[model samples]
Target: METTRRAGAEIALTEMPDDGARGDVDAATQIAAYRIVQEALSNAVRHAPRAPITVSVIADAADVTIRVRNAQATAVAGVPGGHGLRGMTERAHLLGGSLEAGADPDGGWTVTARLPRHPAPEASEGTL
Candidate 1:
């Protein structure tokens, strides 16, 4: 969680170049991404409290990849699960994206979301 916030703060401080870019995301989407990370971190802290959590965000010419991974179920008992995971999934879908949540091969939980750069056009020019 701390790592995630630090990363977001760092990115927020960095400035972008002046070169023309068509796929520049608005503040809303950026906020959404940040929120998603926050939610993921919170979940990890609550569910797998003692586990180490890693949140990564990578933006390239094509798309952005957000990943959150934490150590598997701890020895402790009584960890209820449902709402938070479902909410995260829905949020990703609302943005025309997808979310994946499952156990990692190396014994951990990994949640990843990929939001494409180009979404479907809302309407055609002459359709109306």
Candidate 2:
């Protein structure tokens, strides 16, 4: 949230997932979540300064939903021509989840990802 605020955006965090919602997560999952928010905020700051942003994290027994949206987006820094979305998507898949990022019909940009409540099981040694 501070990232967006620092980027001149009026940020609003409507919801944050509780500890219970996080469930039995692992370090990689936590890092991925943090990175997703970091990249989203950075994009909003770099491309759409002064836009109002809403970020929410909702979690259930099975998965957690992360949403970051801006009211309007301009071509200040061009489209996602970098590794931002790609990295986020990779991280999502690593956690057995999915991420979707695109422009909203409301003329804003939105980045969303759903991550499983539990981390992917580690492959046992000598097991395919």
- The candidate maximizing lDDT is 2
Clashes counted in candidate 1 amount to 0
Across 7-123, the per-residue lDDT of candidate 1 in tens digits comes to: 442112222332245357544345556667777777766666667777677665545568888776563468666587787776666667678988878778878876544434431
Position 127, candidate 2: lDDT:
16
The C-alpha stretches of model 2 lying farther than 4 A from their native spots are 16-24, 77-80, 123-128
**What is the Å distance of residue 43 in model 2 from its true position?**
0.9
